[model samples]
Target: MAHETPRHWDRNMRERLRRGEAAALAELYDRFASLAYGIAQRVLDDEAATGAVTREVFGAIWESPERFDPRQGTMRAWIAGQAHQLAVARLRERAAGPAVREQVAAAATAARADYIVTAMPAPLREALELTRFQRQDYRQMAERLGINEDEARRRLRLGLQLLSSAAQYGAESADPTGGRPAPPRELGSR
Candidate 1:
């Protein structure tokens, strides 16, 4: 395909970066900052690790600005590709630790909050509200949530497990910073 980029595609400021321009880099950072961080978050799942990944990615870019070849593609695509690759590498290396658990916890909390307010997918939202908020039983909320009663029960169980996992992550890890490696799941509690 002849790469028809989206209309909102931010213009590459590489031409303006001739003199190792700080402002140009800043603009690039502003443009792709969320993307880089999000990639980091998905992979590392640890606040510190994510930040480190971002820093290293940009820091490397800053050091070797000429590495960006415009003929290949726009700067955003190149940078996102680099960031995503590196972040994924870092994430894959991480132990399934408290960091992962804590990240899951944060996501779960967000989903729960979203389920409360937004006009989410039909039936699931109703089920969540009834079962979670109205304090109704699974069978009753099943009618509201839309899924089969068994499905509703499964969702409830998953939600509770996520919440509990978050609590455990916080209590066990105590630091969102991925400090020490986590023990294996097979090896029950020490």
Candidate 2:
């Protein structure tokens, strides 16, 4: 059989969930549990709390399948959003001071970046990973990937542009400069 598009899968999942099918719930859990757990862990940084958040996300979906509107976004995105919200709420509850609060916000931003990177197209992701992990320039990336320089630069630019949205996730408390992630600190510099 041909692969199903996300829209079809989302619709089927919503119908199955609305009907309260136990197998559907199990399948949903199997599919999204890792993504939900990863998001929660990134934001909460606690094994226990992340596990709780992951359970709560699935429980909420099981209890209220109607809450997920396919018109708004894909099922994966909705699940991710639920996980992020629950984890951030838990983090806020434990945060005591302004410094900790800032860290909480930063954690949320990092989680968003992770999600974006994971969801981006493979070409863009490869371009970004090469640059970030291997410290490769556009020219070098193109040479390594056997692509032209212009294509490499285009992929890198698009990937960075997509990742930049993570900075806007918590803009209310964002620092100056319109919420861009800070450049890496120079070696031996404070």
Question: Scored by CA lDDT, what does every candidate get?
Answer: 0.64, 0.87
Q: Candidate 1 clashing pairs?
A: 123-145, 127-145
Model 1, runs deviating above 4 Å: 1-12, 95-190
Report the lDDT tens digits of candidate 1 across residue range 87-182. Answer: 887766566576776676666556544533343343444555676679899987777656587888766664554334434443444444556434
| Top model number, lDDT | 2
Best by TM-score: 2
CA lDDT of 68 in candidate 2? 96
**176 Cα displacement, candidate 1 (Å):** 23
Model 1, backbone clash pairs (residues 3+ apart or across chains), number? 2
TM-score of 2: 0.50
What would you estimate as the lDDT of candidate 2? 0.87
